[model samples]
Target: MTNPMRFNARIFDESFLDQCDERISAFYLMWKAKCKEGRIPARSDFDPLDMVKFLPGITLVDVERDTLELTYRLVGTNEVAVRGNDPTGKKVKDTFLANNWEDVWGNYSHVIKNKGVAFDDSDMPNSNGVMVGDETIFVPLSQDGEFVNMVMLYSIQRKAAG
Candidate 1:
């Protein structure tokens, strides 16, 4: 069997947003309303396992006062794992050596500043230090459309089967 990670690459497309059917738009609108109500928690409400079930390549990120945290699930043929980490929780520096926070922070900062969505295709290095092809999308969420409070991210990586 081939183990391929099918991430949510298309979610970042502007045209896709424009063409978002009623179902998707309704979902986004519901999320937006939740953000407005300040009901969304820093932690995800959706089950990590559901991410693997429906959106195998999707990842979520939370933007706190001065940090970016990641909540993700790994789906493989045999096992699954859900992990959460705050790459820059205490200091202004990144905690994880495997992540390039410089680039990621800059990109996320841009999205926050613009109060919009950002998309990019790049090679991400995993824990093993091997570069994996990935597609990422960042969406800024705000209460007043001025300060970005949260940024949602979805990514997918393609890997070869052993």
Candidate 2:
């Protein structure tokens, strides 16, 4: 059997980062503008809600030297407001179950390592056993395109009426 980690690694595209360079650049510009306007103090000054203004399905992750962490806020009508699943200051591994967690972390790791953006779509099973299609974009955060630290954005897709 293949290792679960290996399986998770395949979900991300190698060139996904290259495709999102412009969007990620815009994000950085926004961050810089916020900082100049005194809306931000440090990297921690970012709020997931701020991202929703541009991307509804935005999520954030903080990467330290030893650990990968996810910071997000559940938004949109499709997302069930689960108790105690606050995205801010929480790791994705700690927030999700083993099966789901691996896939989520894998994408985050991919973006960080590639120092680029990644995109994916999947059908997720919810607490009520309902299947929801989720579309996400993972963007790497770096000042000079050298040191990668965090990922931002996790957008979900809504089904259209037939």
Candidate 3:
């Protein structure tokens, strides 16, 4: 359950990748490698082949600066299965996932506002309707290097240890 007064997402420096799972860390590292002169990488900077391993868990969201709205541009198969529906073409504010929508939106907003990255972990609903630990990373992408127009996310789920 979420504490109404607190947000679970944490903003971290890009160097904090060491704290993440190896696969998750590699995703961030790949994005980092695509950066040019510390500028955010554009969506075109990535090649699909390089992200093959993480494709099923990836999501690309479009940011609408004028309305501060975010929409699901692409939702991976794993992500769709986990959420039990495809949210592609739907606004984030209207998407219903187990995680708090406000918190999720806030995290994405933070990434856009700062033109940086963020990391969050929380229990999420799986396809089986059971809760599982999930870790996610949100990275900003900008075509012009001055404004973030998209947020790329990758998530991995794990069962709790007994």
Cα lDDT listed for each candidate: 0.45, 0.49, 0.80
Q: Kindly report which residue stretches of model 1 are placed more than 4 angstroms away from their true locations once superposed.
A: 1-59, 64-92, 96-100, 144-146, 159-162
- Global CA lDDT of candidate 1, please? 0.45
Better of 2 and 3 by TM-score: 3
**TM-score against native, each model:** 0.47, 0.56, 0.88
Candidate 2 TM-score, true structure as reference: 0.56
Write one digit per residue (lDDT tens) for candidate 1, span 1-162.
022232233333355456433434443453445454443323344455534432533444445656444322222321112123333233323342223566556666776666655655544445454545555555665544556666655544545222
Instruction: Tell me which of candidates 1 and 3 scores higher on lDDT.
Output: 3
Clashing residue pairs for model 1: none
Q: Which residue pairs collide, candidate 3? A: none
Q: How good is model 1 by TM-score?
A: 0.47
Q: Which stretches of candidate 3 lie over 4 Å from their true place?
A: 1-9, 96-98
Best by TM-score: 3
Better of 1 and 2 by lDDT: 2
Q: In model 2, how many backbone clashes occur?
A: 6
User: Cα RMSD for candidate 2?
Assistant: 7.4
